[model samples]
Target: MELKPIKTRKIYEEIVERIREFITSGELQPGDRLPSERDMAERLQVSRASVREAFSALEMLGLLEIRTGEGTYIRQVNIESVMSSLTWVLYMEKDAVLELLEVRKILEVQVAALAAQRANPEDLQNIEEALKQMYQDLQKVRLGEHADERFHFAIAQATHNKILIHLMSALSDTMERTLKVSRSKLYEGKDMPERLYKEHALIYEAIRQQEPSEASERMFAHLAGVEASYLV
Candidate 1:
């Protein structure tokens, strides 16, 4: 019987997996001190640098906390927060950002429709406030990306879907970065910001009038416009 060669993995990644397994098996617990890097490196037959890299990654994921001049310890895990952090790392690539914009088109179009159907007075007010902020930013010659994010988030909140809100929260960082890049490029053209504001205004009006189809259409058009501008 012939066996295929084993797939090679990064040493630091393998170290990360081993520690995660220890945590999963209850061998590691919150506030529990980890072995010194030298000890762990010797035990695992890897370089101390690999172990240190793994520790740094774990610290970033909130699985481990490194105190200066002290031993590393496990931290209390919040799965959602960990997942969000992971998502942020995973979507840092240009291709990933473009794919996320595609996903935004799919998700937010539906989200706008839902908002139109379910939004209360307070939700409308929140969206309107975001629009006002966007307009103010435009007047000040700012990118207004944060206001744009708030506008989309307010629409998501209007949906009242807990899972959707959580998904949006997880994607928030990547989404913000994506928008910043796109808006910077788009704003190179004169009147682009005003055009964007008009698109948002149309979407808000459709939602305020409780027209789900119109809201969805306007959302799709707006996202398509942004994507077109980004690609240009």
Candidate 2:
């Protein structure tokens, strides 16, 4: 029932959207072959180049499969790929990295509070291990970025929320890049990494003691420090 007549400069993009809608509306199904580019162009009254570009973009988005000597088929979409693409899109937006930190503060502050209440012995042990690794990495004159990430992820694991875990995982790559940028700036001052380690220690202790309020406060302070460091 939706119209697909091209009216804009970005004809290919509109074509892509129409195809996506078709798939979403159950008009198209996985493994169903699509009309050839020439045929589609003729049907839509658009250039073959526009149709080809549309198909190519859809393929990149994991929406379509184009096989030689065959035809285009709707591929089984992977939600992870869609999530990754969205992250990349956000990464390219203006002030997007800073926006990412704001989002991190929202998710991680609550995550810390929940972790404090929900963590079992094994979860606590994992959190402790990550903190210890941070210290060890610093002693070895390394940045310990991986350890820092593990520390946050360990807290998320303690929350026992599968959806939260997956959301965190989806954003982890972009978050790591943002963290590296922030850490580089923060580490320029004397003893800054040491100070950061202390902050982590405080957060770990709060969670270890199962103090939800303290854990949340410490997590908020830590991220605020990170933002101040990078944005300043």
lDDT of 2 by residue, 1-232 (tens): 3445677887987888789879879998889999998889878889999999999988887888999899898998677556655554555453677788788888999999999999999999999999999899889877777888899999999999976776676567777655666666566567877888899899989998999999999999998988887877
Residue 35 lDDT, candidate 1, scale 0-100: 88
Q: Give the TM-scores of the predictions, in the order they appear.
A: 0.75, 0.76
Candidate 1 residue pairs in backbone clash: none
* lDDT comparing candidate 1 with the true structure: 0.83
Q: Model 2: how far is 26 from its true place, Å? A: 6.5
- The number of clashing residue pairs in each candidate reads 0, 0
The TM-score measured for candidate 2 stands at 0.76
- Number of clashes found in candidate 2: 0
lDDT at residue 170 of model 1 (Cα atoms): 62
Question: Which parts of model 1 are misplaced by more than 4 Å?
Answer: 1-36, 39-45, 65-79
Ten-residue region with minimum lDDT total, candidate 1 = 1-10
